[model samples]
Target: MVNRSQNVYIIAEAGVNHNGSLDLAKKLIDVAAEAGADAVKFQTFKADNLVRKNASKAEYQTRTTDASESQYAMIKKLELDEEDHQILIQHCDHRGIQFLSTPFDFDSVDLLVHKFNVKQLKISSGEITNAPLLLKAARSSKPIILSTGMSTLGEVEQALAVLAFGYTEPDSMPSIEAFHFAYCSVEGQQALRQNVVLLHCTTEYPAPFEDVNLRAMDTLATAFGLPVGFSDHTSGIAVPIAAVARGAVVIEKHFTLDRNLPGPDHKASLEPDELKDMVRSIRQVEAALGSPLKTPAPSELKNISVARKSLVAARTIREGEIFTTENLTVKRPGDGISPMYYWEWLGKTAEKNYEADEKVRR
Candidate 1:
């Protein structure tokens, strides 16, 4: 399990960018590990089981691939079988990075858990409504990261209810009131927190900045009392890096070997150098976000005396001269009385003589 509190768990989503070549897939793993990403994720699904032959492709998919081709045909060319899984897993072990795949069917789920031994399961946004898959994941009891895109809050609630109770049928389940009571209880909430994490996302590929609605991540965190993250589909690394600053415990972004590659997701994906820069920027942001307590930082403490102002004599004055606003002024080198006491210092007799541009004495 990822310790989200310590650092942002970064997953470079290399979905379908391998273009059905094992060599390309292994190269993707190498890129991810070199970029300092925590894991490299791929989509594990048999095209036949995932989509029907007649299913239409989304508009963005049509623009990226052949418009005449069906969704199944497009995805079929990208399927990775069991042998491919073994090769990729072994390569990930050698490269020192975690291997993750989003299972679209029950068999694929089992293959990943039983055969590949994936530590956790990442459920894609489209599968949030798939009851059988959700139940299978819940029974496995491995940590789950669920993405919510093209889904309403009620749909998210229903999915959480299924995971919390390990139930499939929504009609025969307990009432919403009872479900809330159980889910909010100490033990029940703890179990959910231990096993599940929610991710806020927009369903669009290369999602628009106006549609990002990053505040929704915090809303999910507050609503469920669970750790929340952002699965970014934006055009650049700025949004994901910004998500980290806004308290996303995990950040999943699509990446490719080259943006010019012919695929549905490559245009919106980050390249090798950009991926490394994203990781570096996220670490810098995390360090800059430091403590919550509002106090002077170590670097700024030394500057206080040099930058602040002190009460100084505006002109030369003799001993026992009365201090007044015309004779006293604020100046730098704040080793003397602070300007905050300027009002009180006025109308007081000076105990000692002071020269022009010198600090005023009480």
Candidate 2:
């Protein structure tokens, strides 16, 4: 497994939960930093370019947002312009947390790259099929974490191909020869690909536990030979923390200042304390996994005498008499002949008189 020194990258995706208010957006950043998240993420996009004017809302999109509103109209209200991006980034800096925003289209990718100075990039599930968008982001040379929700295996392969072929620079992965450097999504089906991580996710908002198929995340790691993580849409901290125990290297969960906030995602998001608890639980689990060796620990050997057994005389025995099963047995205080020697000692002549319950010496 690739030992990623960057502790679990806990990204609190505050996507559109600000309800189109810049003040609320800054408040979300404060909550993320206070919750100890490594990054606070937003969505950067131009509504007109993001969706067709007539595109319908996703079943999830229709629930918290106005069903009568076209997807374009709904998204327009949530749009964050260049000024908003700059202010959010500066707010993140002031709060001492990294700011990240997923760009939904080609132009937004350019804006995030040339204008926002993002250290890492996130590709939303919807864009997993957007090869041109993936290519634009890949050329920027920033590391990318791509979400694969509602995508088929074949589509992911095509997008990954664009990233791999478009970049002229050599990859930092040990498998790649040393040369130049460029950015790529690192999204292939290769098991154990050190640079890539697969996130187990259910596309449903407030995803049902049964559909999570968390075991598939393990299957992905085993089948692809890469690190695996979880992108949780479940309503609480439990599922994400459980994913960490199951070997997730990264955990991306939605966070908003209040779950009651009016937005498509707020109802499924974690409040500040829950986000903190999730991160802390994940770190605690990482510590608990420890070394796999099974030998007695330094703290366990001292109890051996009190916990194990030794061979002892069960009844009084005369000198020169034969040792019999009735006269010998195993008991605690393990400094004498082990009980494993029972058959060998059976029927042997006794060297001396022995008292009842005394440890027997060979």
Whole-model Cα lDDT of every candidate shown, in order: 0.88, 0.77
Candidate 2: lDDT of 39? 85
lDDT, candidate 2, 25-137, per-residue tens: 99999988888888888998998888899999889879987889898888789999888888999999999998888899888888988876777678887887676676677
Worst 10 residues of 2 by lDDT: 174-183
Q: For candidate 1, lDDT tens digit of each residue in 268-317? A: 89999999999999999988999999999999999999999899999997
Off by over 4 Å in 2: 1-6, 169-195, 222-224, 302-306, 313-324, 331-358
Clash-forming residue pairs, model 2:
190-224, 191-224, 191-225, 192-224, 192-225, 192-226
Q: lDDT of model 2 at residue 222?
A: 67
Quote the lDDT for 229 in model 2: 81
Please give the RMSD to the true structure for each candidate, in Å.
2.7, 5.2
